[model samples]
Target: MNIRKRYLVLILFVAIALGAVGTYVGLAFFADGTSPSGNLASSDRDLLTELADQQETIEENMGKLSKVVDAFSIIQENYVEEVEDKQLIEGAIQGMLQSLDDPYSVYMDQETMEQFNEQIESSFEGIGAEVSMTEGNVTIVAPIKDSPAEKAGLKPNDQILSVDGESVEGLDLYEAVNKIRGEKGSQVVLEIRRPGVDDLLEVELTRDAIPLETVYVDTREENGKLIGIIELTSFSENTASDFENGLADLEEQGIDGLVIDVRGNPGGLLPSVQEILSNFVPEDTPYLQIEDPSGKKTRYFSDISSAKEYPIVTLINEGSASASEILAASLNEALDYDIVGETSFGKGTVQQTVSMGDGSTIKITRMRWLTPEGNSVHEVGVEPTIEQKMPEYYYTNPVQVEEPLTFNESDDKIENVQIMLEGLGYDPGRTDGYFNKETQAAVEAFQQDQELNVTGEVDEKTAEVLQTTIIEKIRNNEDDYQLEKAIDTLTE
Candidate 1:
């Protein structure tokens, strides 16, 4: 093979082996600096002989790929606009990944790859939201707890339409994410199309360093029983260890039951989730099953022989995804624990990042992860044993008011205001996008409670205060019905 052909063959081998072993172990044969034509070690020679035997198949594939090479040459030699070779190569890789139609698989350039590594290893400066491409739109999976995204009112399934007033219509998931992330204290504006809303919402956020402290431990006393609550925000590098330590401390406190809450968690490393699952899932049954592209399945089990002495319950929501879903599924199916809350964000595929030996990488979905019952929750989310929906205002959109909503004016923003008012203990009387006298009374009541002018109208300032108050209440867990159900499940 010529130099270009040899380079392509090496890349193909690397991609194939990376999918199988998740490492570049096949590159060891080439590390000896032996040329293909030069005398080499016996094992290397045997490998080359084997390649020679399959040269026909290799050439056949290469021949089909010649069209792409020809297109690249044509574009470089005679395109209307000048394009760099690096750009073209990266674009080609991205195009291939896009063709797979899998939103989870994506191409990451060197800079993007570095940022990704930082996110997994330590921390990164961003708005702190996990996003995925859904139906050709960059959609928010969930906002990290206490991150700018969450503080800015970004919610799950919110579709990002633009960044800084520039449309993100053609940008990929990472490209849009890069635009949304910046240095700490830098501001980024996102135009969002939220579900069940008539107008697009513009959310401005100041980026900050998002730490990877995933595990949070607390105790909730229910019916005279101290129920330990372990909330995993994400399954980062040290999450398993942190969870173990937190659980140990909770056990030391002599808790009666445990609530594993992954309500708003996005997800992180698979190994992290696997390690955490090993603590609760017994070894008698498989905790997870991974099926490769060829339909081959590999079952993974925990080392534990028995369940925890305390009754355990899991909490999930639409924001719980990937690794979070894995943990909830294993706990529910393998251990027969009760899962409370809404259905989870269904993401059943496992993505593996394969470096291209040039700092760049491709995050490809290499396998499908199944629950212990061998059920896949790809688009269909995990069903809770006891479904507990939050209050209506919990799903309310932000009330963006350019024009004041007075009595007799009906709009979606008015509906949001009504929901917030009702959630804040004000009697809005109606929540069906109607701004009547009752809604005006509720607005005036809210305004008076906040010591603002009792205008009986939903103005910009009133709307802002309403949203802030509602957000504070939600964050403070003033009405966490799902958590209450989880605690009750254990206490009962």
Candidate 2:
């Protein structure tokens, strides 16, 4: 094969391949056809012509490259075993990218790039959890709220031991996920080792088209104040619209205060979170401070703030990272909202996706981000105003409330009762101590959903089911201690 064909083949998985970026800087002169360097006609021609101008230099470098090509052809022609063209080309691509000495700078093939775009930009079919290689282990960062992973009981910091009976210990992060991810409706079994648990937990999950839980709105009346809660799973493609809708709905309801939950949420698109943050910050207030590799700093500002003025509290944890960290930091600096929960997952670096000649792309870390107050939460992470540790093994089996609960009774037990009610999707209004009309209706709905007696009261048996069911959910997901703290911060 010629040098041009080799580049095209290699570029199918390279960043500096001959097309999108123009032929490799030194190799473009040898390739025929209008320079064949890049899409930029003028620049490609000028650069190629410039290389052509130095005949001796071109010849010298071309000879070195030709020798390598000759060796490749000889190996393909006279190898002991048959060698596929694809194997030779892909190997070269991987070798080239590895030479960069940067793990973040990688050459992704078409399939891998497509999967990546589906993840960072949009949606995908999977168990609905964000994972990463932390401390040399494939760890679950966070299961998308209400996604298959959460429903199946996945939690933050859970170490993945195996996938579908195959050990994932030695596999790379991407490789492990590739093995775990599959077609929608297909089952992918994950064996996880939870903290403080000696026995490995076997988790059976069916991959589904994970819904974009970008922003979910839940409101409650605590202390006779209407509290609006927005759980942002990630700043996805639809996050801005969903967030705007949630805010509008809450504003319509005359929301008294706000509690934004970023717990167990891996951050997404930057613009989406920025849009959401803008709603809270004052107009023309600086939001983020970004510094490029060249040391140039840029500060972004908000155009407007939401009309609704209320006290705010944000919930964050180790799973809350990137854009989530940005928002939490911004909220504390600009709005001075009470940030509850644990410290955020520090991911202050920003990535830039550069498309290659083929359909592949390279996502390279290009810049570092800081809070509006010029604080970098990169490795150290963003700490919350109040720290709360979550309870573990709270739902291993069954659970029961302290006592039977009845509607219209104002008592402290009603708080846990309401918590369990809200946790079970019953929507018992504001989780206040008093069981109001909404709480009674939600109780009836939960009873009906569970096919039990349609009682608008949490009796002994009903309290057991509600507690156990919600506790199981909390077990599958992380503890709600962080969120509870945020609610308390807002209510207090």
Candidate 3:
């Protein structure tokens, strides 16, 4: 075969090996401008010879796909509505991927492909959150640090019920993402159903260009020792290099300890995290293992010979996912380091995006990534060595006020308001859902302190102020229990 033909054949072989294309129909569908002749082409024959053991299985599967071809022909010829061939083809591909029952395995159209490419290369105009389909709902994995989604108080695992008032039911992950993304400066309203909150919340966000700067470095003084902090927002393309440079700079400054925080980090490229892992994990054992479809496991190792001279700690929370989990698990399992914080957002599978000749692509979950100890954290997150919970108010849901909440109103919204009130130092008498006389008095006290109308009732203005004030306090780092624990672990 010629060079181009060889490359195409190799790509097809990879797709076939990955179970992405199991039959002649699937193969011919992506062949583009080529028609099936009930026989394999010369290149395909060569490829099949390479898979000689599976040739019988492939042929048997090919014989079973006549039903799909018949259905397509009937739909094209007899359906009352005129259907486009491209649409049907794409739908068929999407259907195959959906049959896997894995949310990470998705088919992306040309437009979504372009947007995905743009997001990886540079900035993209969107709400700036990593999301996945969970229990048939588009759920937020984590809002990017400082993005409009985070600034608007979108939290991890927040289920997106609708975008701009239109329900996202039955829509795939990519479709929901496309709906949530728009031009920079445009408005996108999201209806969120957060866990532990009774009433649904609506968040209005002004979309902006989301930059992909992943690594953030800072210094902290704890116990008369200088500690370096490297916070990874996401494991993007340059995150590994950026982290290396930042670590080098910190070392040059003669820091006593290091803290790696992946609190709200939604993972990105796999290679990126692998590169970062090599810096900490020694060559004594594999940092991680990849289990393929046939249950074959391949171990990957780093070349580092020695551990860091100073003490190191990893900080994680519910928003930490995929690559973040890998780094945390590897460091803890391989190096015996301490991990302090809440459990992570478990996502142990690794996805590989394969192009379908056209601009479209299919991201397939090719393997499950296991920790150095060969444990999978798919649905079960990594447990912290020393468990630490944030303040109660940190987990409070957003209060959506449909009407003024007066005394005797007992609902989850009232409970949220009470929690915020108490967290801000104004005692609501109790954190119960009931809005009693004391709760009303607390609202009045808060209103008066904030220089608002002392209506003694929680109204729209009061709800907004409460949310903004709590967000401000969280952003000001008035109470970061996890970071403090990490610093103490490192310094002690």
Q: State the weakest 10-residue window (summed lDDT) of model 2.
A: 25-34
Per-candidate TM vs. native? 0.91, 0.69, 0.88
Candidate with the larger TM-score of 1 and 3: 1
Candidate lDDT values, in order: 0.85, 0.73, 0.86
Kindly report the root-mean-square deviation of model 1 from the true structure over all alpha carbons: 4.9
lDDT of 2 at 319: 84
Candidate 1: TM-score?
A: 0.91
Q: Per-residue CA lDDT of candidate 1, range 225-326, in tens?
A: 999999999988799899999999999999999999999898888878888888988888898998877898888887788888888999999999998999
Q: Global CA lDDT of candidate 2, please? A: 0.73
Order of the predicted models by lDDT, top scorer first: 3, 1, 2
TM-score of 2: 0.69
Model 3 lDDT per residue over 1-492, tens place: 345334433444455555543334443432221456655536977766856856666556544655665666678779999999777767888999899999999999889999888777788989999999998999999998879998788899999999999999999998899999999999999999988777789999999999988899999998899999999999876898999999999999999999999998989878888888888888888898888778988888878798788988999999999999999999899988999999999999987777676677888787799998899999998889989999989888778787899998898789889999998999899998999999999999999999999999999999999998998787666789989999999888
How many times do residue backbones clash in model 1? 0
Q: Candidate 2 on 1-492: residue-level lDDT in tens? A: 677546643444233333334323312332111244344446878878865655445445554566556666887879999998767866675666556644445667788888878886666999989987766578887888767887765767789989999999765567788898888999988888877555577777899887675777989888888999988888877887888898899999998898888877788766677777777776766778888678888887766755347898888888888888998899888777778877877888775666665686555666788888888998788898888876533324222344556767986556666766665656778766798999899888888888889878778677666754764666554556767677777777
Residue 278 C-alpha lDDT in model 3 = 86
In model 2, what is the error at residue 344, expressed in angstroms?
Answer: 2.1
